[model samples]
Target: MTRAVAVELRGVSCEYRTRTGRVLAVEKLSMQASDREFVALLGPSGCGKSTLLKMVAGLVPATAGEVLVYGRPVVRPLESLGMVFQSPVLLRWRTVINNVLFPAEATGRRDAAMRERAMALLRLVGLTGFEDKYPHELSGGMAQRVSLARALLLEPTLLLMDEPFGALDALTREEMGIELLRIWQEQPKTILFVTHSISESVLLADRVIVMTPRPGRVAAEITIDLPRPRSGRMRVLPRFGELVSVLQDEMGIAT
Candidate 1:
């Protein structure tokens, strides 16, 4: 069977109509992702990584060219895609399973069957026994797990993550990275993640697409050949360090 195209950006660009003047955030950016591939966007702060992600999500209109998902033009927010941001953003009042069910209710997918699936997702994210607990009772990592489960509640074919683990401390972030990889392996999806950390990109992505400074464009595409089921010790491997170094250099980040 031929591989499918999960996402395709053809000379896509996004410009903002700001108070001072029109700002071009991304310019002539083009890329392609195969089905179930995990691609990360790494760059400096002002390089418009978020803008590119939003455009692909159909949350931002491309000022030029096209953004396509599964060969369909992205004209609006796509229901087939799931998004997880830096913050968990869970409603404090909602219980763990209820938070995961929020998307189902909002999208009119609520039903007995949907509720069962939500419960399954909560278990997948390791929240099996915390179904009735509120967000306040969860740790930072646990809250993010809820966010991830909520994102996957609809079983979206494409997952867009904007620094989903960026808010956690060093140790928690590492644990979440491992957890995310495990979840992705168990349930495959095309993922587009944006992160400032080069090591994080090397650790999680199949390929890292580095962006240039303002008016961002693809500066480099680094393929990660590391072995799968990556362990924490992989971070200390020579090849891992090399991949991280390449990403850092592309992003102009000091080593």
Candidate 2:
């Protein structure tokens, strides 16, 4: 079965003008993600991984070349995509359910059905009773779960996640990865995830796009052949270590 392409970047480059001069963050980088595929942008800091996500979301304009989503050119911010950043970025005053429904409310789509969907999403992320709580009342992991739920409120077909678990402790980070996979299985979406962890890239992604530093480009594209519905037990597998080692070498890490 041939899967449809969800995102395609043709010779895409992104540049920014600093006070010093022009800084090329990404240069002639091209990549694509298939429909409902989980693709991770795996690279070190300053590699423009997050920049690529912004271009796909139309938050940043490509300095050269084209970005296409679902076979259409992306000229403006896409309405059919959801984004979750490093921080949960929840409104302090608003309760969990309100934060989740904020998108629908802002777009004038908020109503009974939308509210019901928000509750269901909260439940999906295992935050059923915490809907009435404020951001300050929740722990780091719980806050991120709420962020995940909010991102899924409208059920967008594409999800752009920028190290959503990067801020948590090691144990919590591991827990969230498992939780994310569970949620994804239940509600599948084409996910373009950005991360710097080699093990995380191997664990969460169907394919890892290892990138060069600074003026980012694809260093390598590695397909993860691990069986799906992945668990922590798989992390101890020899194949898993091999895949992680491959990513490390691509990043020039002495592993």
Candidate 3:
């Protein structure tokens, strides 16, 4: 039996009309993310990576083409999808668990099961002990983990992440990447991650969808065959370097 397509973009195009002129951000982009697969949108600045993400999240409408989730047209945000931004965006006053509970409350899911699910998600993100800590008390990486936990609380079938760890320090970013993989392994959800880092894409994604510069289109989609449970050591592997080099060339960046 064939698996279902979790998300599909068909000839999807977006154009913005400005005072100067119409600016095309993405054009004729077609892609599908399989159920439970972790896919990454890898590209340079102005590549419209975030634009595609916004379209999926229903935050912005596509100028042309269709965006579908679970075989249905997505004209607006759906409950089955959750989103995490580059910033944690947690309320400064809310504790970690409260922040996780915020979404449930907003969606009117504040029930016993919802509370249990929120606490479970916090533990899944490895923040079991820091549930009561405020965002100010948490480090950048820790804060992002809370954000991830919050997104998971919605029990979304699809998770959309836009450069979710772009602001962390090098070491912290690397550690968070590992933690993300662990979360993915435990509870498989279809993930669409947008990232500027080639290595991060290769490390975390089952497939890397490389987009072109402005007016972004699908330049290439490469499958990452590296073994799972990937870590820093995978960075030094020969095949890993080759994949990075290929992605670099695709991005028109020097090796």
Please, what are the lDDT tens digits per residue for candidate 3 over residues 1-255? 577999999999999888999989999999999999999999998899999999999888999999999898889999888899999999999999899999989978798988889889888888888988999999999999999999888788899999999999989898888988998888889999999999999989999999999999999999999998899889999999999999999998986
Candidate 2 Cα outliers beyond 4 Å, as residue runs:
none
Summed backbone clashes in each candidate are 0, 0, 0
Candidate 3 stretches with Cα past 4 Å from truth are none
Q: Among all windows of ten consecutive residues in candidate 3, which has the lowest summed lDDT? A: 107-116
lDDT of 2 by residue, 1-255 (tens): 789999999999999999999989999999999999999999899899999999999999999999999999998878888999999999999999999999999999999999999999988888999889999999999999999988898889999999999999988988889888998898889999999988888999999999999899999999999999998889999999999998889999996
Please give the range of 10 consecutive residues that has the lowest summed lDDT in model 1: 246-255
Q: Compute the lDDT for candidate 3.
A: 0.93
The lDDT ranking, best first, is: 2, 3, 1
lDDT of 2 at 132: 92
User: Each model's C-alpha lDDT?
Assistant: 0.92, 0.93, 0.93
Full-model lDDT, candidate 2: 0.93
Residue 202, candidate 1: Cα error in Å is 0.5
